[model samples]
Every structure is written in C-alpha cells, then in structure tokens.
Target: MIIDGHSYCFPPLGEANGFPTVQEHLRYLQREMADHHQPVWRLRDWAVGDNSLLAEPQDKTLQGLKEVNFRSGGYGRFVWTVEGEEYAKQYLPPYLTDLSHPPEMLIAQMDYIGIDRAVLHAHPIFGFLNDYLADCVQRYPNRLFALASIPEWKIEHDSQGIVNEIQRAYSKGLNGLQFSVHNRYRYSVTESWDAPACRPFWDGVTALGKPIFFTICAPCPGSTVEDYLSQLRIWQGWLTRYPNVSAVLTHGFPWRLFLSDHGLHLPDALFEPFRTSSAKLQLLFQISLGNVWDYPYTQLHPTIVQLVETLGSDRLMWGTDMPNVERFCNYRQNLETFRTHCQGVISDQDINNIIGGTAAQLFNLGDSQ
Candidate 1:
C-alpha cells in the first residue's frame, strides 16, 4: 500500500455553498456579520487553502495585484510578475482550488494513482481546520488520515491557551498535527516550534500521543540558509525536550534537488544531531515531490539516494505533494519516478520503507509496519 505523506483536498466549489462562484462565500460572510448569535464559520476563518484565493482572482482589479504578493522572506525568493496576464492564467489551476473536489473525487484519484492512503492537512499558511479534513477522512476511513493544524492565528491572538483547541480537535478524532518552520506567505503567522509560550500546546499534543511533522522548503526569500537551519535546530530542541514526541521533517526535496545540481552537501550541522538522536528520540525525514520536473527534471533527484545511504531507507520516507503536483503529471506517473530510479541502489525492502513501511511504523498502523 502506498501512503502519500503530503496530499490535500480543497473540495471543488460546494454547489450548496455556491462555491467556485463567489456568491456563496459572500453570502456566508454577510450572514456571519449580521448574526453573531452562534459561532459562524466564515469562509476565510478556517477555509485555509482557497477562500481569499478564490475571491480576489474574481476581482478584475485585484488580479493585477498578484505582483505585490509577499512570501516569507528569508531564503524565500521574491517573485515579480514579469509576464502579467499569462502568469495570472497559469498561477493556480482551477481544479486545485476547485469547488467540487469532495471525498469521492479524492478516492477516484487515489485509485487511479494507486495510492492506498495519505496523511492530510489544509493548504499552507491557512489555519488547520481539521473538522473538514476529518469529515473527508471519515468518509474514506480506509484511505485518509487527518492531521490537525496548529491554529497559528488563534495562538497568537487568544491568551486562553491553545491547549483547549488542540484537545478539541483530537477529541473529534483527528490524528496528528502539522506545522512548518518556514512560513509560506508573507502574511502567514507561525509560532516558533520551540517557543516557551507553546509549552501548554506542546503538552496537549503530548497527551494525545501522536507525532508532529514539520514541512520545510529551502530558498526562503528574506532569510539566510542559517535561518532555515535555525528552524531545524529549533525542532531538534523539541525532540530533546520532549522525549515522547516524534517529528517528521519534510520537503527536503528542494535541498536534495539543489544539492544534486550544485554539488553541495546537506550541511552536516543540521543533519547530524537528528541522525544521532534517532535511537533516543523519534525524528524522521520525509522527501517531498511536486511538479519539479519542469525545472530539475524530477526523477528522484539523486539526493534521495545519498540520504538513504546516510540515514538509511528506514529513517527516510516519501511524499507526493498532490493536487499542486497534478500540474506536472498524474499521480501514478509521479511514483513511477521512484520505482524506476531506485533500480539496484537500495534493496526492495529499503524502497518499501520510503514508500509506505516507515510511515506505518511511525503512525503505528497495525500489522502494516
């Protein structure tokens, strides 16, 4: 069974909600303001991946503002829309943030891609609304696992402690939590992974007995590589500070891709501590794949071969960051890169670990490990 560590579904516009079309979202926003009787779910409140994205593009003028977009600075590059109209049209494909992609749509895609299951989360920078994610997973219990998102906004705003929010999400049957050290967009708010203010939040997750995963990407625009490395160190401190916590480090594919072309090593300062602590703590690495074939030619990036050699296949895992990757090719073709590239470098057992076995062991899927 292939388990994709990173995959998402921002259901196609819900016809009931008039989604994909802005009328439904506007209606909800209007009603939310008029009646505050009970808690109202505004589209942007928890609809992380697509709310603002869907609305603004519809505005004839704001479409021109894509030029002013700011992603997190450090190592995050600045993107100027040199090619205007052409870029806007290709910026985000309609299906990715579509209004109709429901659980069934995902199941069909899974079957076509030969993926048996996936670890799920909301879109980057948007807060984690596991309720919607949980519903999707529940409908396809055999195929999806929902990871609760840390409400970065709430934690920053509400002094009541995020423990309650974390507890509530876990009580609802969400499996784990996902946060990133590297903030995706300039407007995205993220608390430090090792902040003292987060003790209560961390303790709450500790109680749930589930692991936390950190998804990382290199070349953060404003920050230096050291800033990115500092984030890794912060996570390492967590592994040392919290003995029971298991963490997954992801999107190492960018680093891998960069290294293969540049001939630089994945700085030992960052990789060594995690490697040494594996026996004493739960720290694993995950390799992410998206539509990189457009630039780096995407066939397993040789970095995985080096990583498997150093960390061992059991310590490394694989993920296909889907929906976003569909722009490259269909899902099955994505996995084909892995199958063909590993030819004789590592044993089949090693390949199994990267594909699904390691996650089964880490997430504790019975008998599958």
Candidate 2:
C-alpha cells in the first residue's frame, strides 16, 4: 500500500456557496482516479485538515484571508476570481454540518481514487475529531486513523491537557501528530523553532516515539536562502542532541530558497549545505507543495531525478499537499511525472520506496521489522 504521508481535504467554511458536499468531494476524487487509470487500492490517502468547512462564516473568511496572505507573501502575487470561485464550488461543499457529513465530490474521488484510509486534523476540537474518526474507522475498519492537532496557544497553559489529547487520540488508534511549519496557532517560522518554550513539547513527542510530519515554509521575514541553509545546519546539529526524534520534511529543505523559475539555474552552491547536512539526519525528504513540480522551472524532471539519485530513494517520500491549495498538478499526475522522469536513474525497488515503502517504514505501519 502506497501511503501519501501528507495530503488534505479541507472542509469549506464561510458564505462561499461553492463548497461541495462531503459526498461531492468523494465523487470528484473517484473521477480523478478513473481519469488516471490507476487502481484505488494502490493508494492510501492521509486526509490532514484545515476543517474550516465546519466553521462559522466569519471564521472561514478570516482563515481564507490568512491563506491568501501566506501564499501572497511566499509567491509575491495571487488572484482570486469568479472563475476560481466557480472552480472551487464545483468541488467543495457549502458547509460541513457534522464530522460524518459526506461531501459528494470527496466520496466520488474516494470511490475512483481508492482511499484506503484517511487522517483528519484542524480546529473546533473534540466534537468533529471524535465523530469523524469514529465514522471513518467504522466504515474502513483499521484503515482510518486520526492525527491530533492541539491548540498552539494552550500548549503553555495546559501542557497536560495537550498531552492528554494526544494520549486519547492514540488510545483511539490514531497514528501520530500532523503539524505544519506555518500552523497559525503555534510556533510559526516567524519564531525561532529552537526556543526554550517549545523544547518540552519536543521532548513529549520524542517520548511518544511516533513519526512527526512537519511542513517547511520558505522566505520567512529576515531570512534568506542563506538563512534557510543556516537553519538546516542548526537543525542537523539539533537532531544529534535528540537521537530518538525522527522527522520527515514535507517539502524539500531548500524549496523556499529557490530564487528562479528555472530551478537548475538557481545557484547550485546553495544546495551543497543541505546535501551535506541532510545525509546525517534521520529525516526523509518529501516532494510536495513548493517542490519542483509546483514551480515553473526548466529541466525540472532531470533536476528532481538528480536530487533523488543523490539523496537515495530510502530517504524520500511522496506527498500531495492536497485540497488546502492545489499545486501545479494533481497527486496521480505528479507521481506519474516523477516515475517517467526517473525511470533510468531509479530502479523499481527504489520507486516503491518513494511511493509507499519508506513511509510505511518511517511510521512503523503494517508488520514491524
């Protein structure tokens, strides 16, 4: 089973009438699978969250704006229009009244794409989390698991409460934690990740000994490509301090550091630091949003292939970073593109590692080694 380590199916929130019903979302996914001519069972979808679809109109609007600001800050410009709205509406539901609310599009997609399991995250705590996980697992048996997202602000005030929530989720068979580097609630890139306040949480996670999936955002204020390189250097040093911690970098380390559309043209020297340090960390690099496929770059396929060759497939995984924002292509398309490009450089066994084996091992899924 190929497990997509990171992916999403954000429920729509707000006055935007264009949201697809839960069933609609599934249906659309089925259509996508059929279009690609891939068997559904070959894929395992991890549905991480921005469950704003269940939020009130005002909250959704606020989150939408935040999303816009984040993207604009990173990409420089963005245009949202009726066409985009209409497109979104075609797939999203207006509201998610309950955790079991089945958006038609998603149902369709799941039917077509063959989502064996799903993991949910995002706001409004207990109600949705409990309901959604129960519903999905009931439907799929042991296939579905929930990944808890705790309130960042409350980590200091109620560390025990947060730990309790994680323990509770795990007791319910939820696999691990799902967090983004830019999580609105917690230590965003704007804050130094190594701050003393966050150390205890890291310690807690290490104690759990479960896999931690984190997104990496680029171009943070007061930080440049060089700064990112420095951060990685620091991270490499930090990893050695805690031997039990294992991480998977959702987007390649230097993704945000690329300055040109032609990825290869970007100074190759910048990558040397990552290449040198990455080899030493118990980290896996994933090709997701902000990765080679999303950006317009010349000879991107070759560049990606070369990177895989250098990094080794055992240290790489595939992620789609779905629904929250569509990258240049869909999940299946990206995988196919990668496979086509790396055919000569990577063997079938290596491809298996990238597609699912590596993730299965990283998360200790299925039978233990």
Candidate 3:
C-alpha cells in the first residue's frame, strides 16, 4: 500500500535519448528492486514520456528543446541511468535478454515488482492518451489506474473542450486528470490560477468531485534564493485562493529551484507562507530528490516535519520526479529515506496517508479500485 505518487516511463529507445527501450528500463527496475530486497507491490510508477500528441509550439525543434529542458538535466540523466558507466552496465544485460517488447513494458515492470496499483499521466500536448491503461486495468483490475492529461493550453480558452476531455477520460474508467499549472500554455498569463478564464475548468473539475493531481512548477528564473522564495509565495497564494483544490507540490519546490547550483539549503521563507494558509486545500509537499537526506540539507527534514505537523498527513504524499531528474534519488530509496527521518514527527497513520492513502483519496482511486 506504499503508493509512489510521482514516477515515469521513457519513450521507446529508438524514440528518445535516455534508455534504449522500454523493456531495458523495466528490467533494470526489476533488478534494482531485487538488489534492495523490496517488494514490487509497494511501488507504483507514473510513466511520463510518450507525449507526442500534446507537443505544443508545433515546431519539432522547439518541442525537442522543451523536452530536453524538462527531462535532460543532470537529474534526468541519472534517473534513466545510473551516474556513469554503471548505467550502461546495468542496462546492457537487460537489453540482451529479450527482443520482444510490450508497449506497456513500464507497466509490466510495475507488475513484476508486485506493485498493486499504478497511476499514469498521458503527455498533454501529444494526443497519445494512454490507451494501454484500459488494458492494464482489465488485466490487473485492482492494480492499475490511469490519470488523463488534459491539454490545458488547447482548451485553456475553450472551457467546453476541457470539460469534454475530463468527461471523456472519466468515461474510459480513468481515475483523474493531471493538470499542469506551469506549462507554457496553462499558467502563463497570470500568477493567479483562480482567474475567470480558468474558473470554468476548475468548476468542471470540482464538479467531478474527484481528486485532481495538480502540479505547480516553481518558476526558477534566477539562481538566487529570492527567486525560489518568490515562486513559493505564488504557489502559497494559489493554494490559499483555491482552498478546495487538493494539490501536491512536486519536484521539491525550493530544492529544484536551486538544484543547478551546489547549494542544498532551502530558504526559511519558503515554508513561512504555508504556516498561515488554510489546511483544507490538502497540499502534499514532496521530498523527491534522494540526496536531501545527506549533509547540510538534513536540516530541511525538520522543517518538512513541521510542515506535516501543521498541514496534517492527509495533505502529504511521497513523490520522486523520475526520468525527469536522476541524481541520487529514485522511487524506493526516496520513500525509505522519507520514512526514516519522519518517524517521530509524523504518525504511522499519517505515514500511510502520505505513502498512498492521501494520493489515492485525493485522486479518487479508492472507488475506482
């Protein structure tokens, strides 16, 4: 029942720069789980790649650049593969094992590892919604859930289209929608997401009465802590305005803001805003990066613990922005580290909520299961 909220799958090897093929990636995952002596059922990966249809700025080169920016940093490299030559060694064995590959090899890996449920997000720009999810759910009824990625940009001005997409996905038995507030098209106009243009979409989602997995990427325009703090305030304001929105702040807001630099410490101001916000919003702050547990940054654990104390476990969830940033973190280890440090600060019930229940409840997966 340990639900991993954020995870990813790469494009087929021939399609992308990261792993060579989906099968290779899955095998590596299986081997990694075995090495750690972990059960697969405890894990759930949210496959992110293969978003060809949602590609905006129609120009292929621009799209490629966007993909590289989002997925090709130092963190991205490590997630798809290990630090150095070890990644090649780790993947080569699996690559040679089998030539036949399923389109959902990523999903297969989850199954092989004993993962009871998996939630998937179809890339928004690319129209290729995950058709595989239905089959996976049919095949492993209790273990698979799909979260449709609505093309907010295309439908941003078209409220009806947005509602149509939501209804379409729901009709397919999909659980929820992965709404991106940071992509160029969605939240570009104004910092306030509760504006009139977006009200209809929000109303539709709220009417669905299902939990929507909302993500707001911190605007990392500069290298200073001030830049990170500024973005944190924007998000805090967002949560404050939409108290009914159940949102999860992924990519460790301030951490990713300063990730390019070597500094691991977060500014005190980031958590300061949330102290006064309402708790009904169900905000789930994640420690996605693995290295957060090491040195100087260990101080962040206490602050995060305090956030949980104030926000409650029902509002917290564990996530690893996999395939997007590799670094020292991934799925299994990140959760283990989070659990290790959060023991006394958070209760077992809260831990369970953070691990899976919260996400499940937020995303409305309970009834689907």
Best TM-score among the predictions, by candidate number: 1
Q: How does each model score on lDDT? A: 0.52, 0.44, 0.47
Q: Write the per-residue lDDT of candidate 3 for residues 329-360, one digit (tens) a residue.
A: 43344555556666766677876777678667
In model 3, which range of ten residues has the least summed lDDT? 34-43
lDDT of 1 by residue, 1-369 (tens): 677776766543222231233443333222221221112122223221322322233322222233323221111111112223111222223454432345676678888867778877654322235677778777877888877765343454452456666667777777777765443222244456456766666666677677676665432433466766766676667778776677777545244333444443566666754664662111212222233234233344455666777777777766765654554456676566565556576678877777777777787787552
Model 3 CA lDDT for position 18: 25
Which regions of candidate 2 deviate over 4 angstroms?
A: 15-138, 141-146, 184-191, 218-223, 254-256, 259-261, 265-298, 324-327, 366-369
Considering lDDT, where higher is better, how would the candidates rank from best to worst? 1, 3, 2
Candidate 1 backbone overlaps, count: 21
- Give the C-alpha lDDT of model 3: 0.47
lDDT of 2 by residue, 1-369 (tens): 655545443332221112234333332232221222111120123222222222222321122222211111012111122212310111211122322233343435434555443334333211224334534445655444445555454454466667777777666666666544433322232455545667777667657766555444432332577766665555555465565556655545544345355544345553453454332111122232334434332245555566556667777775543432232444455445444555665687777677667766766677432
TM-score of candidate 3 on Cα atoms, chains taken together: 0.60
TM-score of each: 0.70, 0.61, 0.60
Candidate with better lDDT, 1 vs 2: 1
